[model samples]
Every structure is written in structure tokens, then in C-alpha cells.
Target: MKKTTETLRGNYFFKQDELIYVNRNDENFVGPFHDHDFLEIAYIVEGEGFHHIGESVQKVRKGELFYLPIGISHVFRPKSTSGQKLVVINCLFSPNLLPKLIAFASEKPTVDFLWRMRDGLLSNYSVRDRNDRFERLFQSMFEQYSTRAPGCEDMLHALLFQLMVELHRSMRESENTDQSLPKEAAFQDLLHYLRNNCEQELTLSHLAHLSGFSERHLQRLFHQHTGQSWFKYWQSVRVRRSSELLLRTSDKIQHIAEAVGYKDIHSFNAVFKRLTGLTPSQYRKRE
Candidate 1:
């Protein structure tokens, strides 16, 4: 029989009423592959090790914070060198632990993180602590959990809230810097507009005007951020979307081509074949 999440709770020594608390400091510990019902926020307090999540193993050093959603089989393997210890502060909690009022009142970023995790979008997400504040936040939360003073639960909630806000900001900044331009709100809006308006006639001048930037400036940023010319990037997006429509809908090839901004069937077939190495008909047949 597959182990349920409640089994993990029993191993972690969770009391009946306490669903959220920090794990005790582990020294030179090797964990077994396990899946759990609750979500886990793991902060490496000290030492270095390998984090095995599903089929991938990532080197985890001190100052890395990772959030593992429910039911991901994972384990931490301590480095074999002598005197090396791996300590992690794991905050485990059920989805129902957080009040609905908190989710409703939280900032958009915080709410976004919650919803993404709930919707199974942010699996195996890890962010290094660049500002060194995340470790401190975990330490403070662990201390509060240990103390159990009056209003400790509220304090834990506040600390977790701050951690979530910081994590969301860090993840956004990391995404912006990862092989892409600083995709702040404006850039995201531009992408959204492009995807929605892919069927329409697209031009650099039109995009530049819509973006409220000069054509030269928009072209420069677009190339620098995406490592592609605006026209090429737009074409790539259109072709990718066309592939989705090809397999998902019974739309005719000419209509699909027109919907993806290509009025000419030959032009669409050429571009799609170049990118996907298969004609649309061939790709759909395989699917």
C-alpha cells in the first residue's frame, strides 16, 4: 500500500493540534525517500548536501530555501565528509492551516504563490538566499515555534507571511535575470498582448507605440532581453501557438495559418517546418 500523508505526520512527531512547526535540527542525517500529504518549506541552516527531488538531484548548499508541494517523493543526502552536518528547518503545514481570510487579504504576490502551489504549478521550486535574510527568517520562525509563547501561532503566521512575500519577490527577480530580459509588469503585459493578439497583423511600429516606447528603444530592449529580433520572436510565438491549435482543435490548416498571423499557407508551412522539423499535417497525424 502507498503511504498516505498522515504517515509522514506520525514520523515527524506532529501532535494532534500542531500541523505547522519547524523540524528539529538534524545533524549528519540521511533521509529516506518519502512522500507526504502536507506542504513543506525547507531552509538549509548549515552544511551542504544533495537534494533528491523526484528524478533529479541538486546540490543544496547553506542559504538555499526550497518549497516542496504535497506528495513529491524527496530526500536529503548529507555529504559523506567527516564533520559535515546537514541541518534543515522544515516547516510543514496543511493547506487548511492558513485561514481563508489571510489568503484573501494578502498581497497579489503572496496570493499568487499560494494559488500556484495549490494549483500544482510550483513544484520543486528552489531559490537561493541572495540577501541572506531568508535564513534569518527561518531561524526566527523556528525559534517562535519552539517557544510557544502567547500569540505564538500569530507570530508564526506573520513570519511565514514575510517569508512568502520575500520568496515571491526573489523568484520574480530570478526569472527576470534567467536568460531573459527583466520581465517586470510591462514586459509581461507585452507578452500577454502578443499571445492574445497573435492572429492580428503585428508590426514593430505598432508594438512600439502600444508599449509607449520609441521603435529604436523597443527594438534594442527586445533583442537584448530575448536574444532574438522582435520579428523572429513574434514568429516563434505564433508558430508555437499554431502547433497547440493543430493538435487540440479540428481547425483547417489555412484557418490555423491565418489565426497565427500567417496569411499565406506556404509561408506558414515553411516557418513551422523550419522550427518543428515537421509539417503541420505530419505533426498532427503523429499526435
Candidate 2:
């Protein structure tokens, strides 16, 4: 079948020799499913909606931020039943900005993570707009775009980079907060983290780092508590999440699989069947 996706051109959106573009829109006006030639940072300003990205139509509400890579097909549709229309602030730029960021930034972990973001080492990410500071920063970028003041292009570029640094800071602070668990957390705290973040890419090595446990120790703990290896335990968590999505939403099988962190639909099918003794399709039909 021919693809129905619309393609957005960078030249059309980024004018005046600008490195960044900023816009705010009421997403209630549903638009064509489209991919673009540049990176995009879209933040929900208010209200609620569904974001159609990849194969998922995930419900999103106010304070959500998404970093979309080039060629990622997506669109926003405001909730039909909501009193308030969904609003979003979008910041767009080419992935080519990475080199400049690298040249200007210090060798900090935050900077390193931003590189991963542009390099596709990390998957698309979304977070709550809990930081008022970021909202103000985004608003400043919008104003800078509309005013076209002297040096506005440079100003917009700086503001965009500032947002990236602040994002890493906020998220790191959040992680530190999560890590405040007592050391004697006895894998309980780490287990809870795995359950809550099953959608994330957490490997045994990473989990060991998070818990200050040796990888071998983590293996033993998993076997003791769950009668499974570390990978098997996490797999069960993801499969359980997949089952919940299957029963609770009308999303496609592929969408459900991705939502649970399975990139390959075939792998998802095999695992779901192995654990539940029913294919995802059959499981859904049984309910």
C-alpha cells in the first residue's frame, strides 16, 4: 500500500537563516499525519488530546513534552469531548544542530544525553511539563520568533539550547529523587522502578548501577523473589503491561507491543504466547 503520510520541508518552516523555529497552535484542528525533515520538540500548553505517533494513538494531557525525530510520522487530535481545546508549543530544528551543540557544550552527562537524543540512541521521549521554568522558556522562544527583533535568530537558537540543558537537568533531578530510596532497599525499590518503567530500556547492568548492586547479586535477587532471571522478570512486566493495553484500549497489536517496549511485533507475539498460552489476538478476543 502507498504511504499516506505528508512530508514537511525544513526550508519551508525554517526561514531567515534561522537555526530554530517556534510555533504555538490549538491542536484541536486535527491535521494530516505527517513526518518532517527536522527534529521537533512539542510541548502541550494545555488541555488534553491523543498523539498519533508510530502506530500508537496515546492519550496525552497538559504538560506533556515530546521530542520527535526526523521522519517520525505523527499528528495531534484534541479530545472530542473536552471543553478546552488542546494547545501545544512546538520548537523545530535540524538534527544537524548536534555538532554545534557538541562544540559549545561541556563534557557533562547532560550534554552527552542530548547527543544520544539527536543520534537516535534513545527512543522518542515524553515527560510532564512540571517545570514552570521550561514553560516560561518556551514562551520566550515563541515571543522571540514572532517579534523578529534584532538578533532574534541567535536568541532563538540560544533559547532552544537552554531548553535542552534544562530538560536534562530536570530529568536528572527527577532521577536523583527516585534514587533516594534507602540502600537497604533490598531490590524492592529497584523492582518497583522496573515495574513502573517497564516501557523504558533498562538492562541488568543499568539496573545494577541504579541499585548499587553487583550484576551477579541482582541475578540472585531476581531468582530468589521471582523464580526468574533478570531478563525474564522484566519480560513478564512488559508482557503484563501489554496485556493491560490489549484489554483496556482499542490500539492495534503493533501499537500495544511498542507501548510495552517491544520494537518487533514478531518478538512480542512470541513472548506473549509463551507467557499467557494465548496469542495477543486470541487473548483480546477472549475478553
Candidate 3:
């Protein structure tokens, strides 16, 4: 079997104490499944391709950048059509190469998310330079590293740090854009629970325990998010489900009331009338 995980010759890419940089231009290159000891940042500068990261294959296009954590097996399969070529810029650096940038990010509110990406919790953490911000940064760094001009090392570090900050900013922006309300998964799950278990005895304590939140906090969130008190919202849900049962089933009023968490017919009738402006019998008769 062909050996997987092509261990890179570190000295060939890096000069002395400098980091590794590569501007790969290939017409039909199929890089082997491999990994590096240091973190790798690969940017597609031209053409499109498929990246085999671990067990998953993701399509990559021009102006896209991917951050690969150390020792994660991956390979590049560049696509070509009508003599077109794929161009990629690879930036490989030691763990300590970005100390200042990492330290600055550690002090930010998105520190947990940054750690998630670094720890490979996101697995395939990638961002497309849709606006060409990262694209230009990579281009400038590649030129400096390839040419080895005077003060090129300093210039490269500056560009690399800028890209690092932009990457963190972009990731946070994307996350914020995707999650507009900042609601926790448990809160959403609670809504799902309420929808399915409207007939069950659900109390503030039970919901707070289920969501791992304080009763007062959960109650505040419930009313703030839905614009209704917990009891009122749950009563509305029970009433809605009861309306459906009334139309679709021949169950009696007392049984229906009990089935929808109402042990007393009078209480159920009063709530139903308050919400729907009609008694269960009247609703059933009309439908």
C-alpha cells in the first residue's frame, strides 16, 4: 500500500529560523495524503479543487483559505479544465511563531471559539476570502517570502499577524451572523419540548433544571423571547393542541381537558374561552 501521511522535509521549506511558505502552481497536482508537525494555512489563489481532510472531502475554490491543525491528515486534489491550473499558497509555521497574535486573541471574548478551531473541534475550519482581504495578505506574504528581500522577514511576520487577526475576526463575524439571537441550544430544545409535551406537567423548576439555568433566569428568558409568561405560553400551546383534538377526535370534554393537562373541566373551559374566545364544545360544534 502507498504510504499515507507524507512527513514534510522541514528544512527544505524553512530557512534557518524562518517559517515555511510555498506558492504551489500545478496543472494537475494531486498531493499525497499527508500532515505536518506545525499548523498549516492553505489558501487557494487560483482555480478550484477538492481537499481531502481526514475522512471528509470538501470542494475548495479560489480565494478560500483553510486552517489545518498540526498532525491532521489531509491532501489536495486540484481540478483542471481546458488547460487551467490550480495555484495555492501554503504557510506553515511553528507553534510559537504567532505568540503575540494568540495572546491577544486569548484576551478576547471569542477565546473559546478560537480554542475550538485550534483544538480541531470544528474539524474543517475554513473561510472564503469573499471580499479578497485574506487573498491580498497571502499574496503579499508569498512575494516577500519568495523574494527574500531586505526586511522581508519582518514584512512577512506583519502580514501573517494581520491575517491571523482577520481570520479570528471573520470567524467571529460569521458565527454572529449565523446565530443572530445568541440563544443557547438548550433554550431552543426547551421550546421543542414545550411543543411536543404541552399536555405534560411542565413547571418553571422542571424547565430550569432541564436547561441548567436558574428558575428566575429561565423565566425571564422565556417571557423575553416569546413575549408571554411561561404559564400563559404553555396554556396557549395546550389550548391549541386541544383545538386540534376537538376537531379530529370524538373524545369528551372532560377527557380532553384532562389529556391537555387540565384536571378540572371548569378551569380548562375558562382558559380555553379566554384564549380562543370559545368553549371546547362550541369549538367542536362549529368545526
Count of residue pairs whose backbone atoms collide, per candidate: 0, 1, 0
Residues 141-218, candidate 1: write the lDDT tens digits.
Answer: 988989889998778888877777777777777666554434344565676688778899989999887877688977
Ranking by TM-score: 2, 1, 3
Worst 10 residues of 3 by lDDT: 177-186
Q: Tens digit of lDDT per residue, candidate 2, span 1-287?
A: 43379999989987766667889998855488899988898988888889988787899988788878788899998888556789899999977776677666876886788788777776577776542556778899999999989998778777887888877765665567565334434476677788778668888899988888999988988998889999999999999998999999999999999888889999999999999999999999999
RMSD of 3: 17.9
Rank all candidate structures by their lDDT, best first, as comma-separated numbers.
2, 1, 3
**Residue pair clashes in candidate 2:** 63-129
Residues 30-132, model 3: lDDT tens digits: 4668887677788988888788878778888888899888778887776655566667888787655655345555466455644554555655479867446
The collision pairs in model 1 are none
* Model 2 error, position 200 (Å): 40
lDDT of each: 0.78, 0.82, 0.76
| Most accurate candidate by TM-score | 2
Q: Give the TM-score of candidate 3.
A: 0.54
- Pairs with backbone N, CA or C atoms under 3 Å apart (clashes), candidate 3: none
TM-score winner, 2 or 3:
2
Q: Model 2 segments beyond 4 Å from truth?
A: 1-3, 81-83, 170-287
Candidate 1 vs 2: which has more TM-score: 2
Give, for candidate 1, the lowest lDDT window spanning 10 residues. Answer: 2-11
In model 3, the runs with Cα more than 4 Å from the true position are 1-3, 80-82, 100-123, 177-287
